[model samples]
Target: MSRFTTQLAAGLLLAPALLAASAVQAHETGDIIVRAGVVAVDPQENSGNVYVGGANTGLEVGVDSNTQLGITGTFMLTDHLGVGVLGATPFKHDIQLKGVGRFASIKHLPPTVTLQYYPMDKSSVLQPFVGAGLNYTTFFSEDLSSAAEGLGFSDLSLDDSWGYALEAGLDYKLTEQVYLNATVWYADIETTATFRTASVPSKVDVEINPMIYMASVGYKF
Candidate 1:
């Protein structure tokens, strides 16, 4: 299993014991929570056939996953509702062509804003929340592989994307001001990659729907 999965399983196994220990106030109106941790973006990608000079090339594109540092902050509008924003360091992904090896690398940032609902009482130590939001992904520093350069590929770029985001998370209070947190998000991301091959302009539409996971330590203020 993945590291995130293993950690999540361990956390769940420990939840019962933790929950039985004591009741603590987790969220309150006017509170702010900040969390920091590792985050992974795993893409479920699909792409249209690469088009060279407006003609189909019969080859599809793919994108590999990445991990990076993540940070999030939430402002409690009420004990049961909050607005949260997610940020991360730039994530780098390898781009591949079907039946071919990796040909490029690209970096992107996904910034998300969500409205979250915490259903449990404010006194509950174990806080579980659900959220819905919007994500904006901007791609930059797209570099072609050496092999791709030799094959006449140049000027790689991917268009920016805007899409919906969904989230679920759990937090276990470790102290009055600190907690252990785990969160997962699903984002709908699409982009068009444009470049040139053998002096011919080329483009391919790509869907990079990704599941994002994070395990964090949070502090309330």
Candidate 2:
């Protein structure tokens, strides 16, 4: 929680100055620059913890992976380092079970604040970076089966979730402000919800350690 406050402050102070930089066009740019990138994240493949209105070990829910559409921006605050923010559409991933078939999409919103270190010059062709950050994931629009009638599902709710991020990526510079960047991050987001489909309402906790891979084109100003 304390970390969230620090991130908030940094974001508040940084955005206005960065946005203003685009207008002046003549100022000596800070190594602390801001960059926007189009990010495409790999599909998420997950298996663990299933919830019904009640606790039943026999039932399980499997989630299918989906391609993620998103954008990530970084504000370089120093010669070799930066802070970043990530925004994306509510991630829609499918839930599948071998016998019960596939179910609805579960949506998630992940926002990250990272400290980045770039290892090479922009003209060097191949530049790599590493970062450590915090990821906050929130769940919404949960659904249940029609056959799951008369279950305590109405009492179910999803609590907000979050994780720690360790990231690494490579950048292929094509031009001054145009480049290709590929990144992979490991996240430990603890997500859980109530299952009302069972006779008694039971809580199902899922620990998802997701390995996210993203590739994108970017512009720096």
Candidate 3:
């Protein structure tokens, strides 16, 4: 398994042990929770063949995963319900082509909003939640590799996407006002990449359904 997966598994295994200690009041109405930590975006992509001037090139597109700083905020509406927003620093991904190395790079931000449901009671130290949300992703800073440029590619761009997202997470209270948290999200993200090659317009449809993971420390007020 990958290092991140191993670490996440370890955290899940340790959560029960940590929850055995003394407990504190979990989220209450009017409470606000803020968290920050590392987040990774792993794309499970299905890419269409590159079309150069309406001709299929048979080259498949791929995107590499990236890790970035993640921040989240939640406001409790009741003891068991909250609204949350997730943010992160721009994630940079390498765009690769089949039979070719990295051909381009792009940066994007995914901001998500969710209605979260906490299933545990207020006195529980281990709080597990599930959420469903919408995600808006904006892509920018698209740059072609030198090799791609040399091959007469230019003006690369990616369209922004709006998609649905699902989340599952756990929070282990360490104190009345602090906690350790781990969350995972799946987002449906699709975009059309457009560029010019040999001065002819080319486009490719890419479905980047990504799983996002975050391990964070949270504070409540």
Candidate 4:
């Protein structure tokens, strides 16, 4: 497994310990919770072979990790059910061409909406929830590195992606209105990268299924 994957697994494994250290509390209906903190985007990416002039290049690509400011708000419809919106600053990732060094860079925004279900009752201090939702990602501000341009690459563009997202999170209440939150989400994202090499525009299919992690402080009102 990759280092990021291992770290994510470790974080999830420590959830029970987190619960053990905090009081159990449940959210009530008509409550609004707002959270803000840092979020990391780690893409477990895969790509098809690149082509140039209708010839296979036998090269694969990968994406590097990025962290950005994350903000979210949740409104409780019932004690156990809530609707939430997740947002973040644009995430920037370096597109690495394996063995051939850095290739390009891209920035994207992933906005998500989900329905969350909390399993505990109102008196509990630690809230653990599961959510399923939709993720819409838009790619922009693509740039080709100097090296890539030197290699005859230009006119790069990445297609927008719309996919499903799954989330698991835990909230530990520190006071009546304050809490610490830890959450992880996985999004199924796919895109087609089109660029010109030697004046020939070529396309590559890429799957950038990313796992997002967030740790934040929240307020309930």
Taking the tens digit of each residue's C-alpha lDDT, what string does model 4 give over 140-205? 999999999998899999999999999999999889889999999999999989999989978778
Question: So what's the TM-score on candidate 4?
Answer: 0.87
Local accuracy of candidate 2 as per-residue lDDT tens digits, 28-78 = 225333334444434343445564444456655565555657677777666
Q: What is the clash tally of candidate 1?
A: 0
lDDT score, candidate 1, position 189: 98
lDDT of 2 at 165: 80
RMSD of 3: 12.6
Candidate with more favorable, higher lDDT: 2 or 3: 3
Model 2 spans > 4 angstroms off: 1-56, 97-99, 121-123, 147-156
Residue-wise C-alpha lDDT for candidate 1, range 1-221, written one tens digit per residue: 99999999999999988976565678989999999999999999988999999999899989999999999999999999999999999999999988877889999999999999999999888999999999999999999999899989999999999999999999899999999999999999999999999999999999999999999999999
Model 1 lowest lDDT segment of ten = 17-26
lDDT values, one for every candidate: 0.95, 0.63, 0.95, 0.92
TM-score to true structure, per model = 0.89, 0.72, 0.89, 0.87
Model 1, C-alpha of 55: deviation from truth (Å): 0.6
Q: Predicted candidate 1: what Cα RMSD to the true structure? A: 12.0
- For every candidate in turn, the CA RMSD to the true structure comes to 12.0, 14.7, 12.6, 14.2
**TM-score, structure 1 vs. true:** 0.89
Model 2 RMSD vs true structure: 14.7
